[model samples]
Target: MATEPSPQRAYRAACPNCGAAVEFRSAASALAVCSYCRSTLLREGEALRRIGQSAELFEDHSPLQLGASGRWQGAAFTLVGRLQLRYAGGSWNEWHALFDTADATGAALRSGWLSEDNGGYVFSFEAPPPEALPPPEALRVGAAQVLGRETWSVASVTTAKLGAAEGELPFVPVLERAYVVAELRNAQDEVASIDYGPASEGRPPRWYVGRGLQLAALGLGGLREDSTRELKGRSVECPSCGAALAVQLATTQSIACHQCHAVVDVSKGVGADLQHYAQDTPGAEGRGGGEPLLPLGRSGALALGAGGTRSWQVVGYVERCTLPEPGDDEQSFWREYLLYNQKAGFAFLVDAEDGWSWVRPLTGAPQLGGSTARWQGDSYRELYRYTGQITYVLGEFYWRLERGQRTVNTDYQGPGGKRLNREQTGEGGDAEVTWSAGAALDADVLLKAFKLDAGQHAALQRDVKPLSSRGIGGLAGLFLFLLFVVIVFSLVRCGRDDCAELRSLYGEASNEYQQCARNTGGARGYGGSYGGFSTGGGGHK
Candidate 1:
């Protein structure tokens, strides 16, 4: 078991602007915001100078706060300051964690950062930057960069602005200012972020390297109580239907109207006029069903090997289909359910015709080859490639999801029923790439996880076959036999009678007869085959 560290000596001073007591816990901190008057105070040796007034922090409903204590590795740390940053898509928080360590002089506080990404946490510490760091404009998405002995893939190049700041900071923050930030990742789940603020000021870029981590693993204490109480019960009226709808997650940007099935945009917050657009309900046009097997707000306990058993809830649902290829008559459809856990973050449960699988977005990029991929010492073979489009959506989502969102996907199969998938959105410099990894989940396990009744479990079950065990010849024969049976049934059922004239003209089981029967609406399940049986899009942010 881990524990927090003992209290350390701190420098106390009076705010020059407000005359309020100001404190700095870390010796390296040069700036402190006055809580009494929102004054930005800059420290010059023993003197304090009033720089400017700091902007008010946004209400992000974050669980962590100043003075929170936690353990990192074998060291104890305390949260001292925070910076709220915003990009075009959304906003996140960067907390300054001061670790208690011993120096030649005595006990000292070291500075690190804990960044909030999507719903997860990233523990990062400053690293020595390379001799020359490229500018944000020169760094392209999906491109590779080499640092020392490691090769990293560019994950994102965002133009982010400093929204607000609180508590003590190591460096003075330029409030409400825009700067370039580039993130890179490797195959080992390590992430590196380059801040160009220093470079813009005629200095080398500052690099911070770390990996995705769960909050529970940090052995944190003094977390905010009832962290989600205020946001969870918030409600707003639907603009389209005028029905009251509850907004569940604070990070949710879009939600669907259950009354009218209109996609409502809550990105501007529920306090503003909600924007909505009507879309056709999937399965209403006689296509595949769009109803989710798992109901929203339903909680389940999933046993994830070394991750242990954790409770997750179904927060969102989406229906997606592959675009019909040339000369193809029908499309393949699948549904994805968004599962959320406060501590574990987000994951997706895909329900395809073949079976169900659990997957989550990865923080690291995998090494891709011509037709193979390597990640975490495992290899994967290509299985399918297609373009998936969102057909329908319901419930809440973190991203600004819209109907007809498309992505080019490449899926791979690994050992022990594991799977890997890559989805690319946009093109060139504006492109964003995401990777997901998981394994095939059993239907019975889900049943147990959700504690479903027998009837519900039966409906959720899929007829998963061990197709790999069957030889290629056996699969071909089985396909031919099923085709023969469908043709025979179509011939007999055409025109509500045995079509003797057609049978004599094109033989008992000819292609021409089968085509005629299909054209006349006699052949069942003959429209088209589901191409490659894909996992629907959900995990990608």
Candidate 2:
């Protein structure tokens, strides 16, 4: 005790596979994945033992690296390790960030995870260890689980594999090891995840809860430069129609033929066994042959509240239909044009038979309970819940898209007739939820914004009854009012001299006029012939 404990220091050893010097920053780290040779090395005393080769990390656009430092909640943290994980859809990075703060004993270290995917970044911290965790079987999707005092709904449950690892990690990661992760979401859009490593090892699962973070908040530096520029603006010929399509984004997986309306798979790059679906022939019943009102590649400026206006190009089009459920006989459908701006992401302009709507995807999850939901402080009531089918598709999509895709849709209406739509895909525990909010727009506004030919998009003109137009009833009332005014003016002018003049002109005929007035009554007194002229007269008072 008097001599004091030796300060823990970094040690270095030569990799057995590549003979390259590898440095381990933590004295407690027993294993390190060699960055030079990607060999799994076991640190035994002062020597390194090569175990196996690790898979090389897949290329991506992430701007992060080991040894990068950042501040979070006024605490300094360093990126010490990372685990690349791949799921059924794609791959993502789970960075192990070690905080500078030490515990009471100062012997243990604390760390968190920075999960980065193509969608965005999510920062999470380990929750207080629970006395016991529910079994994996009990974690059902959409079911509620209590953590501390907050209740979270299971959003997704997926099994992912460890693709690769780097830097000094607190625990050893076995290459190609499979782990179950159950993601939970709260009403506030807060996210939590439970990582269940092999339960046969008899270790308690880990729990983490946190919110999504923007890249600017991380203060990250020394990021790898993105190489997607080389892939952008690449052209690929459609396998079905042979029309050349310009791939706008490197991340695009599928595109539709502009000429033939065929869906083509381009994930393997252009000319590499591109798979395509033939255009669906119009059936004798006349199903699935609707044309888009807005042409693809048409760019329009959209006003985004305080963000001002930005131009978005129409990149994709989908015609979706909602048939009456079960016993119902009504069928409704709508057309949705997908717009994209490289900096602003995706948006939809929906053309329904009744009206048009401009919709944008929601980042914040809405609070849903029963048939009601609250979004951005506004409450919405459920309007319709139905299954939507993709009848036709054109242009490009970020993911693999196909014809006849179906999704369960629930729509809501809020203030000013604003719409909140929730579309769910997949089934059972693997369902994914997407929320979009929009408001009704006039067809004229859309036409002017896109600068489209009004004649060509005549179908987009909705049969909207003018709110101020009261039909023939208003015209009839106006005519009656004008006639009453004319009659009153004439009576006032004629009362002064009209009766006396009639008596002077028709002296002896005055008696005849009086007789005519008496015969015709006061309202229609003048209807007899006088001096070969038919004179119309009224009763004199």
Best by lDDT: 1
Q: Tens digit of lDDT per residue, candidate 2, span 52-71?
A: 87787764444577877777
lDDT for each residue of candidate 1 in 235-284, tens digit (9 for 90 to 100) = 88998889888887867777888888778887656676777877643133
Lowest lDDT 10-mer window, candidate 1? Answer: 532-541
Pairs that collide in candidate 2 are: 526-536, 526-537
Write out the backbone clash pairs for model 1.
none
- What TM-score, computed on C-alpha atoms, does each candidate reach? 0.81, 0.70
CA lDDT, every model vs. true structure: 0.72, 0.63
Q: Note the clash tally of each candidate.
A: 0, 2
